[model samples]
Target: MTRRTVRIAMNGVTGRMGYRQHLVRSLLALREQGGLDLGDGTTLWPEPVLVGRREHALRAIAERHGIEQWSTDLAAVLADPSVEIYFDAQVTSAREEAVRQAIAAGKHIYCEKPTGTTTVGALELARLATAAGVKHGVVQDKLFLPGLLKLRRLVEGGFFGRILSVRGEFGYWVFEGDWQSAQRPSWNYRSEDGGGIAADMFPHWEYVMHELFGPVRTVQALTATHIPQRWDEQGKPYDATADDAAYGIFELEGGIVAQINSSWAVRVDRDELVEFQVDGTQGSAVAGLRKCRAQHRSATPKPVWNPDLPATERFRDQWQEVPDNGDFDNGFKAQWELFLRHVALDEPWRWDLLAGARGVQLAELGLKSSAQGRRLEVPELSL
Candidate 1:
């Protein structure tokens, strides 16, 4: 058995998602597990070169993680011949140019979604990656979540016979920075910085719906900036220009309708921050980040909707919990492993740059649909 190291230039590690999920949980976790076994007797180890704007932050992360390389120079990092892959978790506005540079440097690409702020930019990245013949992919981590995995299992096992509609509720209250410091960055509320609920989350809904049910044919949406004022990281008051909430109805290829309400302003009443209730002819399932519960048609309880008397039915207890048949890894790490295998061993992988473009397209169309106050058709995209 032979072991080889794959040098990955990871940008945007200073950000929350990038620092916590991608860098710490995913890549470092893989390293702790003695790297990934590549089936063909080759162990693939990841060596990440942290790239970001702030030298102090980068150095702190590198030193804390015992990572040898931390760089403020993206160009120099890209010029290094040893770097086999480039991963971006940067702000949406900054992603395209960096990715383009990575593609030009003959590096395989992997990054967070809303690959670009616009569909055109995202598609251009896809085309460039394709032309460069670099193995590329986008983070579709939600698909690998325990609940979604269970949902996929149920779907595959024909538990959800003749699947119908899907209802999703996602988001929680983000504190306005004046009184309480916001959990999310202040830039998330600024439209000029490529921030908005539609652009941020519609890409996720797109892949989730498309992969689980079918491709979206049309989209109808209404977006809102529920909170117009917030404070930045420096405690300075700023106008919140981005929409904090989005209500969307997506028409799928198989006549399935998916309605999703995404909002950062709304308080979370559901078990998870994000939950999806999928109904079908045979059964219905409600899935969150880590848990899934289902009720088959035969086991579903019938409740009277009469307001004359107090409701007595224990509706929540009716659904049976979906058992974890196997261990589930961190979704980001799981996808990273797959992408690594795809890059190293030519493994058959479906979530590529083109798929990412579709996600960006959905976001674009979603915002457009909201702006137009009408349903918009989603046309097929090509490279």
Candidate 2:
């Protein structure tokens, strides 16, 4: 079989998600597996050139990963004729311009969600990519999770006769950095640094709701900064201007209502860090990050609400656990493989820059809803 190489200029490798998920788990793992089989007598090998702002950090990552090329010069990487793809996992605020540059350089572009800080910027990037005729994609990793996949299967199989509503609970307590070190970066709590629960999480919720149920028609949100102060990685006190928690109500097409709560200040009591409960006329299903359970109408136990009697129904045991009949790859890796195929073979890809722009639109509208203290309509994007 003929082997082909796709040179990728990967920016922002020093960040946590960029380093761990994209580079180490996905790209490196794929390389270790002897590259991707194109199914056309050729294999596409991923050759990543790590790009970052710090030379020491880039050198360290290269040394640890056994990478041959590491450079702090992003312009040089973009200018290199051998580079076919430019992937960005940078902060949300810095994505648009870098992606624009990559598209201008005639490279396929892929990046993380909330493509830009504003919906306009995100849409502009999409327009530019389309004008440049570059293959562009954004990370929508939640749709590929094991639990969500099972839920999708249930939906596709018509397990829910008439889908009614969805309730999503997501979050875990983040240390305030007073007595304990903060688990998240200090920038996450500062609005000036493109940090906020709504901005970071609303895009994920938007895509999930849109894909699982339908497009969002309207949204009502309330956001708050529960912890106002925190210490940084340098052990210095700083004010947290951005919100840490957000409670939102999204009205989807077909009259499906979804209530999602995202936060960094709440304690988790669910089966997983993130879970979604969907109730339908025929049955109900609850899906977490890795597991899904369903209770059909026929098997659901009848319960009478009475204050006079002690409850002994054992509600949690009634649901049947969904089995993983096939191997489930990491969400990031799965998307990465798909993007590679889309680029190499001109395969159909639905998760393009425009879809990513919709995510950004939802987040921006959510913030507006919270600020205005009312439900607001979500307009569809045209470009």
Candidate 3:
């Protein structure tokens, strides 16, 4: 049997997102079968090379993973004739330069979200990758999430006919490092690091909003920095500069109103990490990261305002324990597999830089709306 292997060079191999790519995604992607169900035992895999700063750190990481190759010099990695893909898990500030280097080195690129700290830089990287003729992709990881995928199915199936509105409640309190360490990385809480909930999360919403209802037409938003100060790992206080929370309302293609509240300050409400409730003229549905609870007109009671009586119940019992119908995998990991399959079978893969740029645009406009204290129209992007 002929075997194909992709030689990968991974940047930011030691940080959180990068660590996941290094230990989890790369480790799994490099394995045989890669969590795919094969009737018989067989293997499909890729070879990954560690790319990052600090030689001792890289070398130690490689030894721990039993990986043979390690490198501190990105230039050297790019110069290496064997590397086929350049993977960037670098910080937002460093992502653009890393992508440029990869494109110039003539390597296919797969990297994390936002693509760039600025919208223009993100678009430019896409252009460079296009001009360089190397395949490229951004980690639109949210779309691949199990819960959101389930939500997509419900939306596409028209479970709620003629969608009218969407309500999203997301976030949890991140520790201040005094009692417990912050759940999110320090960079995510800083403005200089290109960090902010609106910037980080609006990208996820851009596609979901587009996929579930339709493309967003306009936005009115309010952003906040709840925790003005935080302690890093060393317990030293630093001024928190990023918005920890955001409330946004968007106009979908069909005039549907979609509201999103993303925060890092609120405590979890239920077992659900995220909850989306959609109400239509015909029905309503509520979903979390996995299962969905829904009710239709047949099971609902129409009520009008009355004076002295207590209100009665309104909708059908939730669709409890409705099982998922497809293969279950972690969101980011699943995307990695899909990208690889696209590379192998030439299947249609359209999660391009355009989608990424749109995300950046949404975040930018969101901030704009907040700054101006008015609604901002979302302009269409060039395909």
Candidate 4:
């Protein structure tokens, strides 16, 4: 098979995710990891063209990567005959418009989540993309994580029989940049800029929640802004309008339930990474940020609820860290490769904008449930 050198056009190549996920992956594949393969030992990586709003930044990035082509006009890049795929990692508010324009340009689309702020926008994008007959995808990085992959293997192998419930804890304290000179981009704390814990993270949980267990049936949630102020990249203070923390409970298609607490304000005292605890009628498993544990029916524990118990005492003896297994996990980079392969050859890729729209659906439901003080059932999409 002749290796397809897929030419990629990238929008927002200077943004955080655009740089880390799209450009860095290109750098690694071309310079370090060696370009992608089609499993049959044929390379699939393409020449990448970086595009951004600023000409100087785009030129600098292209020079840094030893890439010659850079563009400030998205329309010109879209019209470029050499560009096969148009990838967007732009802000949440700009995703739909960029994707719409890309679709019209007859290029395949690969983009970030929340496809848009609303489910309707997301679904409409999907419809239009389908009408244009373009291959589209959204990044669901956790599905490819090694640790989570192991957890998935366990579930598929029936390690946790009669699966009962799942508990997910995710977050880390993002400093407010007041004392030690803050780091995170200020746009994240601004709702107008499409930054918030809910908009940023719901897509991840939507994929993980379904992959780890099953489809979400209903959700009850509340959002909070722990830190009301933050400094932007310029060190100027601004009022933080987006939610920094969110708590939600969702019921799966089966009778299974999941509780997820996501935050940008909470510091790690227990697990430093996102973790899941799955309990089944026959057995139970605890998946840590970087590790996992299992307790089978053979070793079912006997304990009583007590008021004077230490925080660490409950699951200590019952939980043992799952083996690192020496398997490397590329959280987002792996997903990038998968999308690349899908573009090169028509391989099956499950993470798409419709899936992302489902996440936006859940977030909207969460907000509705919070506003109405009730649990809201997630209506299935037309697909």
Could you say which candidate leads in lDDT? 1
Candidate 4 clashing pairs?
Answer: 177-182
RMSD to the native, candidate 3?
2.8
Clashing pairs for predicted structure model 3, backbone only: 147-289
Question: Alpha-carbon error at 373 in model 1, in Å?
Answer: 0.7
How many residue pairs of model 4 clash at the backbone?
1
Total backbone clashes of model 1? 0
The true-versus-predicted C-alpha distance at residue 307 of model 1, in Å, is 0.4
lDDT per residue for candidate 2 within 1-383, as digits (tens), equals: 99999999999889999999999999999999999999999999999999988999999999998999989888899999999999999887777888888999999999998899999899999999999999999999999999999999999888988999999999999999878998899988999989998999999998899888899999999999999999999889999999999999999999999999999999989989999999999999999999999999899898999999899889999999988889999999999999999999999998999999998898889889999999999999977
* TM-score for each candidate, following the candidate numbering: 0.99, 0.99, 0.91, 0.93
Q: Give the per-residue lDDT of model 3 (tens digit) for 94-141.
A: 888988988999988888777777788888888888888877887887
**Once superposed on the true structure, which residue ranges of model 3 sit more than 4 Å away at CA?**
25-44, 302-321
Instruction: Give the local distance difference test score of model 4.
Output: 0.81
Q: Identify the superior model by TM-score, candidate 1 or candidate 4.
A: 1
Q: Cα miss at 114, model 4 (Å)? A: 1.8
lDDT of 1 at 237: 97
- Number of clashing pairs per prediction, in order: 0, 0, 1, 1
